[model samples]
Target: MKNTLKISAITFIFSIGVLAQEIVDETLNTQVDANIPGVVAQKEIDNLDDQAKKLYYEFKDTVSEYEGLKRYDDQLEKIVFSQEDEIRDIIRQIDSLDNVNKEILPFLKETVDSLRKFVNLDMPFLKESRIARIDDLDSIILQSNVTTAEKFRKVFEAYQLEAALVIPLKHTRIYRA
Candidate 1:
């Protein structure tokens, strides 16, 4: 009887331990099931935070691009203003050239007339050819297609030739051979 009483006590204690373990396991499973929505909500919040950060960085980049474009626009405006000043200067120079052209032609024609008079009064050496050259210069001065600058060059060249002829005659003497 004593041995049976001890065996029954041991059996009662084992059964209570098993019942406590099952109760603990059931409570843990219930808590895990209830927390499922909270875990999913936390994951969604993290994903939204990541997307917000990405959009903020993109907005900053757009602002930086806008600033760069504004600087470029300012540089272009400066260049346009500078070009406007240059264009005005060019227009003034063109007007001045027109006045110079108008005044130089009459001066060149008078110079050719003076050269003819001087040659007529000078020595008889090569007189016919010199007269012919002066006539050619008169024709050149009257031509409408010739530029004033070209006419001036021709008249100056004729003076240089006459000077050369006079200088050589003064330096050397010619004898009949």
Candidate 2:
């Protein structure tokens, strides 16, 4: 009887220990199940924070680039305005030159006519050559290919040649011994 009672007590103790171990295991599983959603939520929050930081840096870089481009555009505008002013000044100079060119030809013709009259009235020194030079001037004036500046230069050169021929002859009385 004593041996049977001891065996029954031993079996009841072993069954209680197993029941306690099962209860502990069930509590731990429930706790792990309850915490899963919180862990998942923390991971999602960390990912979103990283993305926000990346987007903020990108925004900053974009803003910086826009400012730089705006400054460049303003500089270009100033340069364009300056170039437009220079173009207007050059146009005015060209217009004034056009007026001068229109008036010069008639004036040159009168001057050449006056020079021819003077040469004809002067002393007959170098007569044929001076006449030939005047004739050359007439032909140069009528030619289509010659520029007005060149024609004027030729006339000035002829006037210089005539001036060079005017030398004062020295008057000396011969004393007879």
Best by lDDT: 1
TM-score of 1: 0.63
Stretches off by above 4 angstroms in model 1 are 1-44, 127-147, 172-177
TM-score to native of every candidate shown: 0.63, 0.61
Query: Candidate 2, which segments miss by more than 4 Å at Cα?
Result: 1-9, 111-177
lDDT of 2 by residue, 1-177 (tens): 999999999999999999999999999999999899989999999999999999999999999999999999999999999999999999998898778767877777777788789788876767889889988988888887998789889988988877776543124344679
lDDT of each: 0.90, 0.85
Work out candidate 1's RMSD over C-alphas: 4.7
Model 2: how far residue 161 lies from native, Å: 7.4
How high a TM-score does candidate 2 get? Answer: 0.61
Model 1 Cα lDDT, one tens digit per residue, 1-177: 888998898888888889988999898988898889889999999999999999999999999999999999999999999999999999999899889878888887888889899898887889999989899999999998988788889999999999988997777776769
